[model samples]
Target: MGLRPAHPFLRRVPHSRGLRRLRRLTRRDPVQLLKQLPEQEQRARLLELLRADLQSNEEIADETWQMPSLTADGRTADLPGFNFQTRVCDLQILQGVSGEAMENLTKTCRLLFPLDGSSWMPCTADPRCLAERLAQEVFEFHAKGFAFDPKRSGAEWWVQIRDSGHSEEGIQFHWDTDEVAVERHGVNVHPHLSTVTYLTECGAPTLILQCRNSLRPSETAQVYGSLAGGTLSWPKLWKHLAFDGQLLHGTVPKALAKRLGDLPHRFTFSAFQAMPRWSPVSCHAGRFRTRFGRRRLLHEISCRLPHRSGDTTAGTLQLHWASKDAMLGPVEKGRKREMVSAGGGEKKGCLKGEIH
Candidate 1:
């Protein structure tokens, strides 16, 4: 029997009676609630939503696409075409933590998982302690069916000092989420949702995206959005990794294509996304292994690829949480480097005591 792909939408919490009642009480239409944000925020949120949806659909298509791999022994490897690669894959489910909790977690992650090198936090509140606290809070919230205000929450969050802008040699990020690529007369119907955020704003590298199969340098590669004061959220988290550059091909419709051809510039907008990293732990005979370690291994795997970067900013942080029933295809045996830039870069060991 051939392996099948799992639909990420199935994991979504449907609009049950209790959920609808809660939404009514909160006056938050989870589907159309994004319009309530500021104009810039609204655009960013919409872009993310569309990008995620498109990416999911693409993944479904790719999984079903007939592109089996041939092994060294001439055997057929049942899988989709090797089109996209994950720059980073980190996954975590935030429970009791408010938006503030997620902020603090991001800070901790930047400190703990620097691309340039490792840096230590002065405080005792490390990743493990924070994860435990978040888990407990999430459990409580799930049990009680209530939402906490991240801004007003009286939680003591540790904030990392960040630069106002990127350094000349900034980091880069690229990704694809699932969506339909049928562009109309002139509109670019982005089918997936993907995001890239910069940690060290100083010398932050500009973003660049293009069609995966474009022969020339790029017809549509330029920088987009800033992560300084933005937040991005989709209907759910799993939707983030459903598509990539492959589906991005032929995604832009004629109208936007004309504008893009005329302007030939990246879309600079304000956006925010919560990139949560979780640790997968296992214990056998009292010995333990953390997902962080597994991720490091994955990073090492990426490091070995032929397409490596001399600049330390080239690395990406991947986060994911695997469920037993998730229908992930077999792990192919070779390096598959992603051509897109999904996340921003970080300066090595250059944490300033305070932002200037």
Candidate 2:
């Protein structure tokens, strides 16, 4: 048998005139064009171009990981304080596996989001391990990234993984503990870290938080915009409280806050309740006692209870303060918001919040 030549048509496709024209169109300096056009016109044109690009890329076979299909219909996990922020109305549904989970989810803004494909991107190792993984990842990432001062600072980190779903298509994300405080401060609270994945094909992993924490029944929640799948890390918790970093950085002027009464603090209470899978005592012995509260501090022991049993609630309540202490601050009532360092004395009351 003789070796055969590859198709010349395939080899020469790159030099096609159509491709050349497309390259020319896409290669133009968008900044230069924007400079030439009126500001409003420039913004409109850019949006149109972006929409066109997104639409055109739909047919392009994504070279990245294959997105998981929603094979499992839907499953829900109901636990205490699941909706402390929004009443017992929080709901989280497990869809399926996403691509390689990333760390430091908040820092995703640094890298352009991979918008060329349809896929679920998880931040934790396994679906069951979501909360644990989220907590650990946030801790390690922030510990390394944020230069916290131990002497003058009692800075705390709060982490919560919420189940966000609606109809057939939806998403879930990590909520900050300081959400309530941020609303009061009219400042941005760093999400610090978050993990998000889409449920449907057209579903994008976007975090939509209402500004001013709207109370009107007729008004809908504000849309924060699409969040890329990955880890985001930041120093102070105050920086992420706003709607969009673009507006925060002044890269783009926004009318949302002024027009819609959108304050940086407006956000609906996240509806995912966190159940503590592990306690500080599990981390060590002397450490657990030192970290937990002296008022209700009980011996470190594991006792199985029904999914919704009263005993489980009691157990969760006991460990709640300790967990918050461990995670630092920005604690939410009802959910495990922090982790107590083994042996650290419980010096603070449940950092001010309604226990879900």
Candidate 3:
């Protein structure tokens, strides 16, 4: 079987990927070049724009999101039952994102991943889209060389919102887990990485457990629990956390989900990413070696096409971070355990820092 990428307009072409890219780049009109400035001037102007954006991006992040500038302790917290190491960070950087950005984001979420929606929402792979840009920055800075292949990557995002009023809808312990897609050449799949970007903070503390999904391809959910992982609470408005998607995790104890009487509505933006189309992940080793020889889906994200309802292949195609268009820089440090000082002293039982 061959690789079928998650793009409505993309198809596996039996040609030299390199040659195709060269042709696209060189097909430019020579007549236009004569009317424009020399190549050196173009290169210098491009660098100027990049440098200017990079400098202002941090300032914009501080003002726009209003997240704290806390630094991470840099210690990887060990999940008890699993072999993965997770680190937390404060991702406070973005420039030129207008105040309406959040409004646009929530609007998209409601349109795509409704509050009562059951199916995961797919994102169009536009380099200009906010979600695509943020995901690219996160993966580049935080993926830390995880075992991901650029060509086979898939992405899906969803949102979860709970009003401050008491409710019994808190999540229980679970893994993001794998499932089979219904596409023509569908296969088993799981998100290689999962992320949570807090849009608003309440008293809810997300308990990331020490368990990882070791179940077989056809296996069902397994029982999991332990105090070996870590607890993240008191999130800054825009704090971000990431970890192995397969690890067992949950937010707020069922009993306390409703009793945080003084907090704002809980809203979060989450994404499952880098999920290659295969089960038992090792299957990738053999598939990549044989199919399409050395071809790759390099232009997947940059090409914009008309979207179709029947195209379930809609997912992000992140441009390589090394490309000239990377807009945000890596966060300086992961957020440290936050301490809430009241009256005269720090709150006695704030969740301990996950740093080991």
Give the Cα lDDT of each candidate. 0.24, 0.23, 0.32
- Return the lDDT, model 3, position 260: 19
Please identify model 1 stretches exceeding 4 Å from their true place: 1-96, 113-162, 172-208, 213-242, 245-356
Clashes of each: 54, 34, 3
Tens-place lDDT digits, model 2, residues 1-356: 00001110010112212222233654443233345789798667556644665556333222432222111211011122211121111112222324422222322211112122111212222322332233333233323334432321221222212122212111112122222322344322232222222111211122222122112112212312221111111111111211211111100001111111112222222323332333334432111111112233211211111112122321111121132232211113455645332221112211111111
Model 3 worst lDDT run, 10 consecutive residues: 285-294
Taking all chains together, the TM-score of candidate 3 against the true structure is 0.42
Q: Give me the runs in candidate 3 sitting further than 4 Å from their true place.
A: 1-84, 92-96, 115-124, 144-148, 166-169, 181-189, 217-227, 253-356
Poorly placed runs, candidate 2 (over 4 Å): 1-36, 40-44, 57-356
What is the Å distance of residue 48 in model 3 from its true position?
46
